[model samples]
Target: MNAEPADQIRLLEVQALDSRIAQLDHKRSTLPEHAELERLGADHAQLRDLLVAAQTEESDTAREQTKAEQDVDQVRQRAVRDQQRLDSGALGAKDLENVQRELASLARRQSDLEDVVLDVMERREAAQQRAAELAERVAAVQSETAAAEARKAEALEAIDAEGFRVAKEREVLAAAVPDELIKLYDKLRGQGGGVGAARLYQKRCEGCRLELNITELNEVRAAPANQVVRCENCRRILVRTADSGL
Candidate 1:
């Protein structure tokens, strides 16, 4: 393949632009905010699950408390009815004695049910506290997550803008080069880590960071200016300049 000497230099400019774009893309992916957001997201999800569990426990305790209170109320109502019957004096001696004993039994039963109601109330209060604490934690995490997401968005937007600008410059520069040359460069870039061209400076192939051997240097020196030459070691297009030390 052959391209003008000037065109080969332009290819280096295109390579520089491509490298800048790649750097911007890497910055976008590796931004500190991306990792922060990931950590925050995991925390948010775990906290939400805990909050939901606490709320469910609170609801269950609430229903238990209600049922206990109803049981206490029913017992109290029965005791009151029995006491009224004893006060009416509408019974014989044997019947009055039985009514007195029945009233005593009802009082004991009511006391036991009231104790159960108190126990249920205490448990419900604890559950409510737990749920409240979990809710607050969830809200805090959500706020942090939102802030992280905003930061990530801002970073991505900046990187994308710079990448877009650099890409436009590369497109214009690459368009001026011969399509055949650009095609070969693109292929080599894909095969060799993103770099398709390198300058031969001080008898070194900058792409592979290796000094060209005497034989390779001689071959490159003898090549025509219009001919496209590749580095023997790295297989990258070698663009020579006055500093090549040839």
Candidate 2:
């Protein structure tokens, strides 16, 4: 498709803006804050799971401690009743012997129960400490996540603002080119790695970064000044300039 030479040059401007917009989009997607946020999110989830497990352990151990204490109390209460019976002098000799033996058994049971209580209490304390540590970790991860999110937002805002500006400039440039020319350029850009036009500087097609052959250079040199030229290698609209080295 043929466009005025000046119009062809405008295509380069539009292409530059498009390239800038593409770069901005890339920057937005690959922001360091995005990766950091992802890592923080994972850490937060793991910490939350640990906290839940710790809390469950704490609760279970607490229940065990409560039961142990209750057992100790029950055994002590039985011993107290036996002692009161002995003090009352209300039992025969054999009955008194049986009561004293029962009190001794109760004392052994009470000691065993107290040991169980102590063990459970230790477990509960450990669980509580683990839960506290996990909670602190969760809080730290949450703080980092929040900060990363804020940084990500700031980066996106900056990228979007620049993208908007470049897009606006592209709109003006695209309006200057004829419809058919713009259509061809757009199609080429889609298939040509985001470049639809390039400057022919020093006999090179800047789009493909390849120098044109002698025959191609001669053809371009002979082409009318107002006619549009394309690079034989990259098939992009080749904009000529004084430095094209025709």
Candidate 3:
């Protein structure tokens, strides 16, 4: 392929812009906020699960406490009725003795029910505390996650802006080159490592980081100034300048 010397030089500018665009893309993906958000997301999920379990326990304990209180109330009501009958003297002697014995049994039953109610109350209080603590932890994690997401978004926006600017510059520079030359460059860039053109500095192929052998340097030195030359090692367009040391 043949391209004007100036046009071939412009290809290097396009390559530089392309390299910058690639760097910006890499920076966007590897932003620190991305990792932070991932960690925060995991914590939030676990905390939410714990919060749910605590809430369920709290609900269960609440129902248990209510049932226990109801049992205590029923026992107390029955004892009150028995005591009223004994005080009214409405039963014969034998019947009165039977009523007194029933009252004693009801008292014991009420005491045991009251103890159960107290135990249930204590358990419910513990569950409520645990649920509240877990809720606070979940909220803290959510706040952290939100902050990380905001940071990630800001970083991406900046990277995207720079990439867009570099791409526009590349488009303008590439447009000035001959279409056929651009086609060859694009093909080589796809096959190579994002570099289709490189400067031959001091008789070295910058693309492959290898100095050209004596034979390769002689050929390049003999080539016409307008003729496009490729590096023997990397097959990239070798853009010659005064520093080529031919």
Candidate 4:
């Protein structure tokens, strides 16, 4: 493919722009904010699960406390009724003794139930504290995730803007070259590790960073200025300059 020397030089500019675009894409993918956001998201999920568990525990414990208090109140009420009957002087000695014994039993029951209520209340308090702590953790993680998302968005926007600019420059550069030459360059670029053209400087193929043998250098020297030459080693379009040492 014979392209004007000027058009061939434009291929190098297009290659530069393409390379920058590729770099920007890579930067967009590997941004640190992405990794941070992923980590924060996982942490947020785990904290939410823990918060749910703590809330369930607190609720269950609170119910247990309520039931214990109700039990105590029921036993106290029975004791109160028995004492009132004994005080009414309507009972015989045997009946009064039975009433007093029943009241004593009720008092013990009430005491035991009160103890249970206290224990359950303590447990409920602890569970409530745990729930609060978990909720705080979830909130913190949510904040971090939001910040990370914002940072990721900002970075992506910048990268995309720059990539768009570089692509536009590539388009303009590509348009200046003949269609046939552009096709050839595109095909080579697709297969040449993203480099379709490279400069031949000091008898070296810049694409492969390999110096040409004497015979290869001589053939390139004999080629006309407008004749397109390819690197024997890497098969990339080799653009010659004054310093090519050919």
Spell out the clash pairs found in candidate 2. none
Q: Per-residue lDDT for 61-145 in model 2, tens only?
A: 9999999999999999999999999999989999999999999999999999999999999999999999999999899899888
lDDT of 3: 0.91
Per-residue lDDT of model 1, residues 113-171, tens digit only: 88888887888888889889888988998899888889889888888888889999999
Give me the runs in candidate 1 sitting further than 4 Å from their true place: none
**Local distance difference test, each candidate:** 0.90, 0.92, 0.91, 0.90
lDDT of 4 at 124: 91
Between candidates 3 and 4, the one scoring higher on lDDT is 3
Off by over 4 Å in 4: none
**Worst 10-residue stretch by lDDT in candidate 1?**
116-125
**TM-scores of all candidate predictions against the true structure:** 0.90, 0.95, 0.91, 0.93
* Top lDDT hit: 2
lDDT (tens digit, per residue) of candidate 3 on 50-148: 989989998998999889988888888888888889999789999999998999898889889888988988888998999999999999988888888
Q: What's the residue-level lDDT of 208 in candidate 4?
A: 94
Per-model tally of clashing residue pairs:
0, 0, 0, 0
| Candidate with better TM-score, 1 vs 3 | 3
Clashes of 2: 0
